[model samples]
Target chain A: MISRRNWIRYSGAGVAASFIPTSHASQGRVVVIGGGFAGASVARELRRLNNALSVSLIEANAIYTACPLSNMVVGGHRKISQQQFSYAALSADGVNVIHQPAVDVDPERHLVTLRDGNTLNYEKLILAPGIDLDWQALQGYDKTAAELLPHAWKAGPQTTLLRDQLRSMREGGLVVMSVPKSPYRCPPGPYERASLIAGYLKQNNPRAKVLILDSKDSFSKKPLFLSAWQSLYGDIIEWQGESDGATVTAVNAENRTVSTDFETVQADVANIIPPQKAGKIAHLAGVTDRSGWCPIEPVTFSSTLQPDVHVIGDAAIANAMPKSAFAANAQAKLCAVQVTRLLNGESPVHGKLINTCYSLVAPDYGISVAGVYQPGEKIWTEIDGAGGVSPADASRETRAVEAAYAQRWFDNLTTQVFA
Target chain B: MIRTINRRNWLAGAGTLATLTVQPRLLAAVSEPVQSVLKRDFPTAEIQPGRVNIELPALAENGNSVRMKISVDSPMTPTDYVSFIQIIAQANPLPDVARFDLSHANGLAEVETRIRVSAEQDIVVVAGLSDGSLWSGSAHIVVTVAACLDALY
Candidate 1:
């Protein structure tokens, strides 16, 4: 973990270096699209590893709202500002951070075109565009419908909208959440959201209910979540898996209802997490596969279909590795190391990769899953006898400790990647 | 060198190989719980550090079902083959995870199955050969608390 003192020290250097022009005579240029955990980490690490290399990070938003702890904001336990981060620290670290949307990519010419009709050239390109919700996958759920039924998946204004809706809802009203199938970002996120929302309603609106409609029969950390619901929230939170005909086929945004083959249920407020695909920039770069995600070579994370282009984070199809911030940070570091080696005319070897995902069942209750992975012949293989979840019968003290650790992890990770 | 030996040559050379025994190098390195389990299971045999390989995730997402694969470097011929394999999770409420019996008719000395790991602990796999010598391999797994939430924003 990086200390705040170290971050301040780097910021001091950035202040002094900002006056002088960056040297461009050493290494080739690297252009990274997207400024989330993956892209931001790679850009900063590249500058740290080889200061001579010119690195430019393109992101559409000026302030990034994190998805990790946004559930707290939705549950009215935390403020949205707490989840917001700026790129100023990264800019101070000698990274050329650009606040603009990337509209097109010409891989043949190694050029990325911004929305303002400006283009950036690069020797190597890294894409960490994350996931874009599939609007067409669910009928009657488009950008306009999102205004009525907030997904809150991106953790910004949508998060506030959902929170406000819950606050104004009637005491006996039902808040419905629809979850997509497997391979979506944050496999266990909807449940965590449900848990936190239920906790909020249990205190403020005692009679309100939170219903989860899942497209899949099972979810990550199922037993722990179920036990938490049973012990903490009781019947305030109810779940219907795919086998129970809870798969949402369409959304009637006007009536605030979702329809499955079995029935159509109206809700006071609907949160729809639609199906997803690689972000637009990834698709423009021609790196995504039929699965609508980028397939990368296990060792270096380069695109299997395109040369000199690498994809990381949720945009990449990482076997056995869930789409989480921890996994993205791990992948970004490895990608940075490999990209450096390749630029120096050396072969890239596999490195130690691990992921730790922590979820908050309540304000003081937390759980996590961790795994160590190795690059196999074609994909990543989870190392045997190494990783598992928390014990079923853990004490309250254990849960509290994990909750503290989760906060520390968020602080350390955000500082490492963005600050 | 073993990879180049033919099946017929391996059978013919079994008589000389049967007398060779590997040093018990892992005996001093294992934890106390693992040592106790090993001592109870193979009191008379020297548990050596070769021939057996245990493949499991270094970290697991769930402790309820963890996939484990164990393979032994044996000819599996009538003359020299693996007889049985025993698995033990030193920290589990029940130390014994599972046990598998094998024979020459099985063709290969490999077993794949899933086991529940209660916590972070060292899992040991012991293979008993037809010659009465025991070979072992072990892996340490960390069972973390699982939340599985993605921070992609």
Candidate 2:
């Protein structure tokens, strides 16, 4: 997905609306459900492979808002507008970007049913519908709490709401962040949220502490985060890991406080990241595992439970990989190559995969981890010592260069996926 | 004007239909046969057992990327070595799963890796013993959230 900053400010809303309601649509068909990273990537990729391939991307929202860098938007670094991007890029690339929600997928008929009552048929269907919030997993913390404490996982307005909440808070007002345990959409997301909040906290409200209540005892990039937190915020930020029994099991909307299994914490603002699952369509299509994700072959990415269906990105089970946009991009590219092979009647060749997830520790401070894996014993096995966290003592100049590279990385990825 | 199936699509499609036509091939492979590649490589008779086993997480929170380990219950003796092992997810999109080739030179008939289990399903590990015996083991897991769904969500 594109970052919220570029998407919001950089994109012109009415940009693609002209060519969107097309004068004509061609015959061949390639249906892409989600317009996010993987969906957009696959859609653009298939077209690039064969311009004649009928490509249509169905996004739930007309304006494609991004989730990447949404933490910055929430931290008040910049407005959400700066993070936004228009679907016009997809259009320019000859992708039929449909602004509609996809409701059903009938593999038997090779058809996708849209909420608008339109049925799209395709020879090759790519479903990159991203993720959906599993509100049922947490009681009393439904969409209502999301309004009070937005997940901002999907970006857009929720991100703006989070920023507004942060901006309007009185000095010394508490900020509580709720982080899911594991296997969520973004592994380092909550930690990044905390870091960015601490960034905001350090600048704006020194007396106002930012409390991070996590569902896990530890988190991604722990060493770097703790060190930075200590160096930057010192006593300003208080982190309560899961071991402290601070997992929020319930939320009291009236009281504006969250109740964990152990203790109750009240804050001026809260960010509750609910459990996540595949898009509702995957479950409806009966391709999702009991864990609410799709299982696929390690080599080809074809669905394990279903014939003729393939799952990619965050929706598929790619081992030893974190749920980050970069990993999703890697999975999508790998799947794209696999799809090309499968379409050509050749089986996908097994090969080593490389994944590098770069997270911004601070504006000028960046850290990353890289991994390489190959199919072994019917699954992906990480090559020993092939990947690890960025060194703890990395210099400020290096971090600054890495941060700049991070921006360029997002640019390059979006261009690769959509442009 | 051009309505021809690409040779590979035709092969994949025809191979799929041919399996339905050849009931005996499916049944034969089920009990005593092997994957076409394996069968082609080792056209010998039955497998004589040494031993093979798979180790994996008893439970995983995110089934998308679950770790798995497979080991042959064997002492890589020249006289008796586990030649190959296949790990298959009985319920994944592709049932063929992953295939591994081993020899005495490797010293160990063991492998460890991470697997994405779509749902709570049985992971089946089949081993080809040095003597040409095929032994199998399966594990049933309860996956709270499968891997693929996380991506598409």
Candidate 3:
């Protein structure tokens, strides 16, 4: 799509640079909204692609924590400190990172307004704000339920809170996790959480059970996780897909009972992962469709309704890919490439992408699934047989091998997105 | 090109002057054959007659990722055991989602995991019966996001 090199090349040729601020056309200001995987990656990559191109990233949260391995943090395999990362890495790459949310995107004026009331004009704008939870969907739950039974979808404090609650659970306690319907972030995530908890239950509290009260009958990486669970935990885990009447309707946090339309479930801990939509910014910008997601052109990540604005990550509706860390990172790379090319006046072409998601079944064990994607007639198509789940009935030694590879994969992904 | 020419010539022979064209490249893009294996090598299934069971949620909230349990009522015995259990999501990016190799020593014929559902489609699980006969079952799900292998533009 838009590549940075294309911008410099084209700006120096047939066309002038876009989105200039007043007569000060000499400044190369690039403002990026959001600090998650997509935003952080683009901001860092843009600066690295061109040191002379100024870049500023605005994120509401000071720490750009990852949701990728937060399940392990919650499972108590590793401390939350393991999940904590700093923006110093990004800053070292010459990016001007700002800890604030974008309140407005005035494409017509070529400016972005932040929560702090400062307007930053930009020559290029990148929007990577993550998804927002539909807190109002459940009947008995509201913003109040989230305070008690946190979704922990976004990493950092929410993830830490869930971890603390899990650590405090009784030896024979039940953990009730509700998986919201589609279009949410990290499809295979909740299952990994259950697997990790069950892995812990296998060792510390053999009598304890993890009950997954799912909204759907299945999940991502089902075979690998199930194979791992059966081998590792035995009956330590109980799952209710749909035939078990698994639909989450409400939550009574004070009593720790999650209510579905059919019945109410009482548990020691509850993690209510609700359905989601595009970030509120998209809604406010009048960019969301009836599905509560943002639809964009399959070619460039640009908005179909708005100009000079691109939404990536969980916030954007990339319909073919699973909402996982790999997809977001992949989208960021393609978006960056497209942004650079678009700025230079060359049309972008289609290219296949690869994504692999690694989930921890235990500290020393792991599983992964991968995909190889190419353009279909209208959308991207993951080449059949190009990917599948990690082998089932894996030896513990093989699991350990997968675990090592998983760690390496995480490090490589984080580096790709930030470094 | 040959077929288009022949058809056009046939039309011309019938006194119909209409030029026809075709794109020959459209014939090569098709899905490959998917195979499911059990245990270490052989793709086998243990049939306990009517004891095979799969537990899934009735109404799935998210089709993107669903939780599932496969339980077969086969006694984990040395002579009589469920050899392998395999699942296939025909609509997912890859059809063969997961397969498990089992032996009599494992004692339980139950497995659970999270699987991706590409759309509102039926998920099939095959328990290769010990007698070369395969017992297959299916479950339908409503996937909201519909697995986006083509998700990115």
lDDT by residue (A20-102, candidate 3, tens digit) is 34455444567788878888888787766567676777777766678888888877767666666677788767677776677
Local accuracy of candidate 1 as per-residue lDDT tens digits, A359-395 = 9999899988888988876567677777767888999
Give the C-alpha miss distance for residue A394 in model 3, angstroms: 3.9
Error of 3 at A76 (Å): 1.4
TM per model? 0.70, 0.70, 0.70
Write the number of the candidate with greater lDDT, choosing between 1 and 3: 1
Off by over 4 Å in 2: A1-28, B1-153
Rate residue A98 of model 2 by lDDT. 71
The candidate 1 chain B region of ten consecutive residues with least summed lDDT is: B1-10
lDDT of 2 by residue, B44-77 (tens): 5443322545555443655555557788777888
- Cα deviation of A224 in candidate 1 (Å)? 0.4
Give the chain A TM-score for each candidate: 0.94, 0.90, 0.90
Expressed as tens digits, the lDDT of each residue in B1-153 for candidate 3 is 000001111122111122111112311211121222222223233322234576654333344456788987677787777877878665566667888988887888888877765554455566754545455455544343334222311
Tell me the chain A TM-score of model 2: 0.90
